[model samples]
Target chain A: MEFDLIERIRRHTEVNRDDVVEGIGDDAAIVAVPSGRELAIAVDTLVEGVHFPAGTAPADIGWKALAVNLSDLAAMGATPAWALLALTTPDGDEAFFDGLARGFAELATPYRLALVGGDTTRGPLTVTVAVHGFTAPGEALLRSGARVGDVVMVTGTLGDAAAGLRCLAEPDASAYAALVERLNRPTPRVSAGQALRGIATACIDVSDGLVADLGHICAASGVGADIDAEMLPRSSALLTHFADADALDFALAGGDDYELCFTVPADRAGEVGATLARLGCGAARVGRIVEDAGVRVFDARGNLYEPARAGWNHFAA
Target chain B: MEFDLIERIRRHTEVNRDDVVEGIGDDAAIVAVPSGRELAIAVDTLVEGVHFPAGTAPADIGWKALAVNLSDLAAMGATPAWALLALTTPDGDEAFFDGLARGFAELATPYRLALVGGDTTRGPLTVTVAVHGFTAPGEALLRSGARVGDVVMVTGTLGDAAAGLRCLAEPDASAYAALVERLNRPTPRVSAGQALRGIATACIDVSDGLVADLGHICAASGVGADIDAEMLPRSSALLTHFADADALDFALAGGDDYELCFTVPADRAGEVGATLARLGCGAARVGRIVEDAGVRVFDARGNLYEPARAGWNHFAA
Candidate 1:
C-alpha cells in the first residue's frame, strides 16, 4: 500500500529534467549534476503537532515540509534542483497521501523541482524533506560574512503567519483566512535569494522569527544588530486583526515566518532592494549590523524592548 | 537544547573532506562534487517499535539507520561520500544522543562519509538518513539491466538477521549471540558492490527477504528467475541453531538481511564469484534469470516449493 502511494506520488511529482538519470523505483536515484557549481543541501523535519498545529490539513503539512527545506536552500543563494521525501504516517490513508502529494507538487512545480525519490514508513505523522540545489562557486551566500556596519534586510511582509497561528486559537478565525494561509503555505524566497547571490554578504531564512534568525547571522558573522521596531514590515491584515502590542510582538519575535533575513553592504542596500523588488518579494532594511554582541531592537523612543520569547527552540521545555 | 546535542553530534561526526565546503552549522550545507561522476542518492527511515523492537540500544539504532542507507548505495555500486540526518526524538536525553552519535561515527569513519547537514526535531524517535554516493557515468548497477539468461548471485549469508530477531525473543537466546549481532548490525557489502560494478548486469540489496528483493529486480528488468533450493548458501551457525526446513524457509523468505543480490551473464559467473571471494564476502550462484514472469524454486526431488510469506509489506497488517 505504501508502494502504491509512492507510485502515485512518482507520477505526479515527476519532472522531465535532463540531469536526472534514474528517478523513483530504484534503490537509489542517479543524477548528473553540472560540474564547477557547489551543491547546497538541507534537510528539515516537521512533526504533525510540534512543527505544525493539530487539525492542519495534510496538503498544508506537505507544502510546509518542502517549503521549509527549500527556504534553507534559498538562504544559501542556491537554485533548487531535486528533493527526496521521507514520510512516516500513523495510518497509510489514500486520502492523506493524495492531499500531501498534491501539496508537494503544487510548490515543486513552480520551481521545476523533481521529486527524485522518497520512502514511506509506518509511524506518527512526520515529514522530512531533503533538498539539493546549486550555486556558482563564489556566489553562494553564507551567514558568516556579515561584517560590522552591514545592513540587515528582510524580504516580503512579516508577522502574518504567527498572527495566523494566534487567529486559529480563537472562535473568529475564519475572518483571518489570508493570515491562516500564510501560516499554512509559506512562500519560500527562491528567486529573491538567487538574485542576492553575490550581493548579500550573509543570508538566513526566518523560520524562528526576525530577532532570533538575525541573531544567527550575528553570531555566525561575529557581529550584532540593532533594528528599529517601527521599520518592520507587517501586513495590513495582520495589523488590522491583532492589537498593536501583539502585532509588534509577533513581528519582532514571532516564529514561523518563512521570510529571508539577510545582510548586505550598507552602500549596496538600495540596489539590493531594487533587485528583490524586481523578483516581486520586496526587501526591507530593518537593521544595521553592529559591533555589539547580540540582536537588540529599539522602540520608537530608542529604548530596548524584550520579546515574550526569543524564538522557537526545539528542545526548550 | 537540541542545538547542544547537535553540537556534540557535529563534533563527533565531523570529517575532513575537501569536497565539503560547509558541513553542518549553517542554513544549508555547501558541497563541491567532483566532475565526471553521476550522483546516487537514497533515503531510508527507521521508526522505533516499527522498524526495530523497543528497548533496542540507541547505538545500534543509529548504526542500523546509516547502515541501511549505505546498503542502498552499495546496491547502486556507488562509493559513499556524504550524508544528511533528520532525527526526531521524544525525549532528548544526553546519554541517547552520545550513544547514537558514537555508533553513527563508528560506521561512518570506515567509509569516510561526512555528516554534512541535519535537523533534530521533537517527536517520536525516528531517524531518516539521506546518503549521496557516486559512480562513473554509465557504470552504475541498476535493477533494470538483468537479461533473461543472466546468472543470479548473492553476497554473504542470508536469513541470519531474521533468525537473530527470533533468537532475541527466546530466553535461551544467549547461545545465539552471533545471530543476535547479525540482527543488530548487518554489514553493508560496499566493497563487493564496487567490485561488481562493471561485471554485474543488475543489482539490488536484500532488505525485505531474498525473494522480495529478487522480485524487485525481476519486476524492473522485465524478466523472471528460477533457483535450486539446495544451492542456497547457509552458515554453519544458522544450520546448527535450527532444523534444515526451518533454516531453508528463513533463507528464502526471511527479511532484514543487508546482503547484495546481483545478476551477471552466465559466462562471467565464475569470475564474479572469484572477484567477490577476493573481497572476503564470497558469492554463491543460486539461480538463473529466465523468460518467465515470476520467480519459482525447485526442491531436490524436482518438486515446486512455495514460501510461507513472500516478504515484508510495510502497510500490510
Candidate 2:
C-alpha cells in the first residue's frame, strides 16, 4: 500500500538529463560537473522534538531543514551548488513532501543550488541535508588557525533565540518580540564568512552558545580565552526582558544564536573590522586568545567573573 | 542532558590529520583532498521501527545502517571516502552510541573511509548517514541510460532478504538460518558495481522489489520492461522455505534484495556476463527492456502474471 504511494510520488518527479549520469533508480545519484574545483560537502540533520519544538509549522520546519544545511556551507565560505535531501516521514504523505520540496525550492533557486538527488524512507520526522559546493582548492576557512593574542569577534547579537524561546514558554511576552523573529529566521552570515576567507585565523558558528562554541576553538587551537563581559553586545529588548546579569548570562551562554564567532590576529583585525564595517556589520573585541588553559571571564573593571553553567548542551540538563 | 554525552563520546575518537583538515569542533568539518575527482554523496536514514525491526541486535543494526549507504556508493560505482553520522538517542545507556560507532568504525577501516563529521542530538533513536565517495569524472553509473531493447540483468540471486524477513517474523523457525543472515547483513555488490562502471547502460539496486525498482528505471529511461520469471536466480534456502509460486512472487518483488539490477545493450550483454564472471560474480540476462509503456512479467510459456502489490511504502494500507 505504501509502495503504491511512493510509485506515484516518484512518477511526479522526473529525473532525466545527460548531465545526471544516474538518477533515482540507483543506490546513489550521480552527476557530472565541471572538473578542477574542490568539492565542499556538509551534512546536517533535524530531529523531531529536539531541533524544533513539537507541533512547529511544517513549512517552517521544511525551510529550516535546508536553511541550516545552507548555513554550514555559508560558514565554510562556500557557494552552495547541489544538495541531496534524505527525508524520513512518519507516514506517507505526498502533500507533506510536496510542501517540503516547495520550501526547499524557494531557497535553492536564489542560492543557485540544485536538488540533485536524495532518498525517502519511513521513519521519524528527520531531514538530513548533504550539500555539495565547488570552490578553488585550499580556500575553505577552518577552525584550527587561531593563535594566542588574537581578538575574538562575533557576527550578530546574541541571546535572541534564547529570549524567543522564553517568550514561547510564556505567551504575550511583548518584551522580546524582536528576539522571536531572530530565533525563527536566523540570517546566516554567508557574506561575512565568505569575506573572511584569508583574514580570520579561525571560525565557528555560535549555535551552541558564545562561550561553549568558543571553547571548541580554544580546544582545537590549543589556546585559552579571556572574554570581557562588558564588550559583549546586547539588544535593548533582551536587556529590558532580563536583569543586567541575566541578560549577560544569556548573551554569553545561550545556544542557538547561529551567529559567527571568529578569531582574527591583532595585525589583521583592523582590516577585517574595516571591511566588515563597510558591509554594515559590527564586530567587538569580545575576548582575546590567551596562552592559558581555560576560558576566563572579566568584568568592566577587569575583575574576575564566573558564569552559572558556562553553556547549554544538547544531551545535558 | 544529551550534549555532555556527545562531548564525552566525541573525545574517544581521534580524527586523523590526512582525512580531516579540521575535526569535530567546528560548525561544519573541513576536509581537504585531491582535486579532479567527482564526489559521490548519499544520505540514508534508519528509523526506530520502520527500517529495523524492534529489538534488533545493536551491532547488526549499526553494521546494516552503514552498509546500506555504502551500497548506494557501490551502486553509483564510487569509492567510499568519508561519512558523516547524525545520531539521535534516548537518554542514558552510553553503550548504545559506543556500540554503533564501533560497528561503523570497523567497516569504515577496511573500505578506507573515515568518519569525517556529524551532529549528535537527543531525540528518538535515529541514525542518518551522509556518505561521500570519489570517482573519476563521468565514471559513475546511472539508471536513466537504459535504452529500449537492452537486456535486463541482475548481479546475484534474489529474494533472500524477503525470505529472511519471513524467518524473522517466525524467529522460532529453524529451517532458514542463512536466509535470516542474508536479510540482516546484506553485502552490497561493490565489485560488480565498480567493474560495470562503463559497461552497464542503466542501473539500480533491488531495494524496492525487482518490479518496482525496475519501474523507476523504465519510467526514467522512457522505456518499459518484460521480465521472465523463470530466469530469476534464487537461493536454495528461499526455494526450500516457501512454495514455488510464493518464492517466485518474492523473487519478483522482494524489497531489501540490495543486488544490482541493470540494463545493457543487447550486443553488450555478452561483455557484461564475461565481466561479471571475471569478477567472480554472477550475472544473468533475465529479460529485455520493452517499447511498451509499463513493466510486464511473464512466465516461461509467456503467460502474464501480476504481483500482489508493488513493494513497501512508508504510508499505505
Candidate 3:
C-alpha cells in the first residue's frame, strides 16, 4: 500500500539529473558530489502540532518541512541539490500525499533539487527532511568566523511569519492573508545565501528568535552584538497590521521566519547590501559585532530592550 | 533545554576526521566527500509502537536505529562514513539520552562515522537516521543487475529475529537470549558487502524477510526466482526453539532479520559461498533466478509451497 503512495510521489517529483546515478527504488541512493566541493548537509523534523499548528494544510506542512532544512543550507552558503524526506502519517489517504507531494515539488522544481530517497512509516504526522548541497572548500559561511569589528545584517524583512501565525486566530484572517502565507510558505534565501559565500563572515538562519540566534553566533565566535530596534526592517503589511512596539516584539523575539542573519566586515557591509539588493531579496544593516560576550538590544530611546519571550525552545515548559 | 541535550549528544559522538570540516552544533554540517568516489545515501524512520513494541529499552532503540541505516549502506556495497540523526521524544530525561548515546556510540565508534548534524524536537518517540557512505564509481551493487540463471544466496541465518520477537513474550525468554539479541542488535554486514562489490550480481539486506526482499531484486531485474524450502539456512537457536514448520514460516515470511540476500553467477556460486565463509558469515545457496516474473517456492516433495503471510508493508491494513 505504501509502495503505491511512493509511486505517486515519484510521478510528481520525477527529475532527470546527471549527478544522480540511482534514485528512489534502490537500497540506497547513489549520487556523485561535484568535484572539489565540500558537501553541506542538514536535517530537520517538523511535528504536527509543535512545528506547525494542528489542522494546518498538508501542502503547507510539506513546503515548510523542506523550507526549514533549505534554510539551514542557505545559512551555510550552499546550493541545494538533493533531499530525502521521511514522512510519518496517521492515515493512508492518497489526497494527503497528493497535496504533500505537489507542495514539495513546487518548491523543489525552482531549485532543481531532486528528492533522492526516503521512507514512509506509520506514526504521528512528522516530517523529517535531510538536504545535501555543495559549497566550495573553505567558502562555507561559519558561525564562528565573525570578528568583533564585523557588521550584523539580515536578508529580507523579519517578524512576518511570527505575525502570520498570530493572524491565523484573528476574526478577520482574510485581511492578513499575506502574513498567514508567510508563515505557511517561507521563501528560503537560497540564492541570496550563495551570493554571500565569499563576503559574509558569519551566517545563520533565524529559526529561533533574532536575539537567541544572534546569541549563538556571539557564543561561537567569542564576541558580542548590539542591535538597534528602530533599524529592523518591517514589511508594510506587518506595520499596517500592528502597532510599532508589537511589530518590534515579533521581529526581535518571535521565531519561525526563515531569514538569513549574517555578518560582514564593517567596510564590506555596503557592498553586501548592494549585492543582495540586485538579487532583489534586499538586506538590512541591523547591528554591529562588539567586544562583549552576549547579544544586546536597544530601543530608539537608547534603553535596553526586553521582549515578552526570549526564544523558541522545544523542551522548555 | 534542547540545545543542552544536543550538547550531551555532541560530547558522546565527537569524532575528528580530515574529511569533516565541521560537526554538530553548526547550522549545517560541512563534510568533504572523498574525491573520485560516489556517495550512497539512505534514510529510515522507526516509530515507537509501530516499528518496535512499546516498553523497549532506550539503548536498544538507539542501537537498532543506527543499525538499520548501516544495513542499507551494507546493501549498497558502500563504506559508511557520516550520519545525521533526528530524534523526537515525549520527555527530556538525562538517563534516556545517556543510554541512547552510549548504544549509538558503541556501534558508531568502529565505523568512525561522524555524527554531523541533526535536530531534536518534542513529539511522539521517533528516530530518523540518514546515513552517507562512499563507493567507487560503477561499483555499487544495484537491484537491477541480477540476471537469469544466477544463484540466489543469503548471508548468515534467517528466522532468528522473527523467532526472537516471539521469544520476547515467552515465559522462558531468558532461555532465548541469543534470539532476542538478534532482534535487538543485529549486526550490519558492512565488510561482507564491500567484499562482494565486484563479485555479486545484485544485493539487498533482508529487513523484510528472505522471500520479500529477494522479490525486490527479482522485480527490479525482471526475473523470477525458485527457492527450495528445505535448503533455507536455519540457526541452532531457531531450530531448537520451534518445530520445523514454524521455523520455516519465520525463515520465509517473518521480518526484521538484517541478513543479506544476494545473487551471483551460477558458475561461481560455490566460490561465493566459500568467500563468505572466510568472513565468518556463511552464505547458503537456496534458490536460483528463473525466466518467470514472480517468486515460487518448492517443498521437499516438489510440491508448490505456501506461507501463512507475505512480505511486510508499512501501510497494510
RMSD, each candidate, Å? 1.5, 3.5, 1.6
Query: In model 1, what is the error at residue A316, expressed in angstroms?
Result: 7.6
TM-score of chain A of each: 0.97, 0.86, 0.97
Cα shift from native, residue B75, model 3 (Å): 0.6
Worst 10 residues of 3 chain A by lDDT: A308-317
Computed on C-alphas against the true complex, the DockQ of each candidate is 0.91, 0.54, 0.93
Candidate 2 lDDT by residue in tens digits, A184-244: 5666666777888878888877877888878878887899999999988887888878889
lDDT of 2 by residue, B1-317 (tens): 33444454454434454756655545665665545666677777777776767676666676777788888888788888777777776765778767776666666666767666677766677778878777777778777788888999998888888778778768484567788777767777777888888888888888778998888889878899999999998888888888988888888877777888989889989988888888776899899998896889998889998876577442131
Model 3's DockQ score: 0.93
List where candidate 3 sits over 4 angstroms from the true fold.
A314-317, B313-317
Candidate 1 C-alpha error for residue B287, in Å: 0.7
Q: In model 1, what is the error at residue A270, expressed in angstroms?
A: 1.5
Between prediction 2 and prediction 3, which has the larger DockQ?
3
Best by lDDT: 3
